[model samples]
Target: MDWNSFWEGSKDLSTFALAIRAIILYIALIIATRLMGHRQVGILSGHNYLVAAGIVSLAAIRMLNPESSLTSGIVIVFVYAFVNIFLSYLDIKWPKTIDRKPTILMKDGIIHRKNMLDCHVTIDNLLGQLRLKGAHNLSEIDTIVLEPYGKISVIKKPEALPLTRKQMNLPPKMVALPTILIYDGKIDEKNLHAIGLDHEWLMTKLREKGIANPKDIFLAMLESDGTVYISI
Candidate 1:
């Protein structure tokens, strides 16, 4: 085979074919990433970032290699997909291995220097987050947690002279997050099953609200306190 002629022929393939391959690869990567879960995106730890980089790099290589058959590119995509799926299953089954260690930045109002060193976190980062949280001073904090997602969670210590409940004047309890049963006129069966209800129950609820079909409702929610709200 003449290598130069082969390269020339490969370059001569229709632009539409190249565009379609790019689109297909993009869609596959998106689906695979979503299947991996949102934690993969939020917690860009060293390991997680490496995994994401590897996936993108592989896809880009396959996209540029026009000489490689489409079937070969798809096979590579599926291989990565399968590996991700298997790892995700293992993580769910044995969470301890995949679970991240909690970095204790503070305990009993004292900073844990050892933990900070291990996690490579500096006092400046911690103080910056604290300031964002409206903490005027470190002395006001009782405890602080450096969450796996790189967020600093702070709790204020109770004052030496405790205030009465009435004096504190705490706000009323906020309502729980609404459960979306239907989105964009489609019944979310997985969400329904998660909340221990089925399609029949959903239909019955809709009928009571004068909605004959799930498609007629633009949004449907079930609050934790057993309140059902629907919008058409």
Candidate 2:
């Protein structure tokens, strides 16, 4: 057993070279993911999953095979990202053709046996999922839809649903999004500008909070109601 050859491949690329290659590919993948957008990470379709798998395979090949060129691997990663972006555009453009609609597996407290069979879901599996969703029996469920990603979405019967503010005749409250002002000690200028805030305003707020520098704060979030939350 050659320890040296085992630790470092017999090829021209050394262990250190492989480590650097892995790091470069890792950064490239991150950039590619950013280019593909948040949807690629949030809700991945079957084709999107395939694209991710293919990019991973390419990166692995580059790191493992000394004969593999970094340029070729990086090109493949970019190509996969671009192709996924294009496919995503097409999916949005023609959802009916590219994507499958959610199947109604249950309706009106009764299981749609044909849909269950078509989706390859058994009664036991359906019962297990129903239990996981806190439905004691089928009678409590008004509808159950099997999503394209193989997840179950359950809608409870009108009587079984939770009471809302509207039911109590309560006034609706204003809801606002929290904007990230500072993350990892860096100011998000675009977000700050979007909220009609400038650098001077941030500085004044930071100073009021006894924060001498933006780098001193780990995270700072501005709420919709003009409240700033700072964490060091």
Candidate 3:
């Protein structure tokens, strides 16, 4: 082929390669974001928003830059991955710096108008999100927290009931949140300590439930009523 024809052919090949690279980069970013966690997409906080925006911007540049090589796109992907890992480490080591703390936007059923304004959230939007979460009335909401990730959490006050003993079908019992004793065939030591238990205590409890080993119990619960429920 003549030099002119050869050059033209190479340009066409580069275009095709760039198109493929763009598609791959786009899909990889989506997968990476998903793997990072669901919160990465739902909560657009400081670093999270930047990371998401940067990915889209870089992908566009890769597709548009005809001279951009495959290695350049790969480098961008690695850069994003490293940033995510570093941020996660910071979040673990110093939670206060990395994770956005929840702010009280509403207290005692009264809305903090200044806070709402600062967050760029209106009463209508707040009520809409709350209603979606099954909160029908503002009076029912005890506290509304504006999460760092631009999400609002509504906590409702305990419902009032008649003061008749006959109406109370069950005794006043405090229900403890269920703890994961074993996950993926491995014991969670942190959870054990949280529940004030040790390996020996768990083994003994397992034996009473006819579970030969901790692995035999898929899920176990220790209730405030001093009851142990085991699921295999």
TM per candidate comes to 0.58, 0.68, 0.57
Candidate models: Cα lDDT each: 0.73, 0.85, 0.72
Candidate 3 structure quality by residue, lDDT tens digits, 68-152: 5545566776678678767866876987788877778899889999988887888788988888888878888789998877777
Among all candidates shown, the one with the greatest TM-score = 2
Query: Model 1, which residues run further than 4 Å from truth?
Result: 1-9, 41-48, 64-70, 160-232
Q: In angstroms, how far off is 144's CA in candidate 3?
A: 0.5
Ranked by lDDT, the better of candidates 1 and 3 is 1
Clashing pairs in 3: none
Tell me the spans in candidate 3 whose CA falls farther than 4 Å from its real position: 1-11, 14-16, 23-44, 160-232
Clashing residue pairs for model 2: none
Highest lDDT: give the candidate number.
Answer: 2
Give lDDT tens digits, candidate 1, residues 121-197: 88888888988988868887888888765777888888733576557797655566778998879988888998789
Best of the two (1, 2) by lDDT = 2
Against the true structure, candidate 2 has what lDDT? 0.85
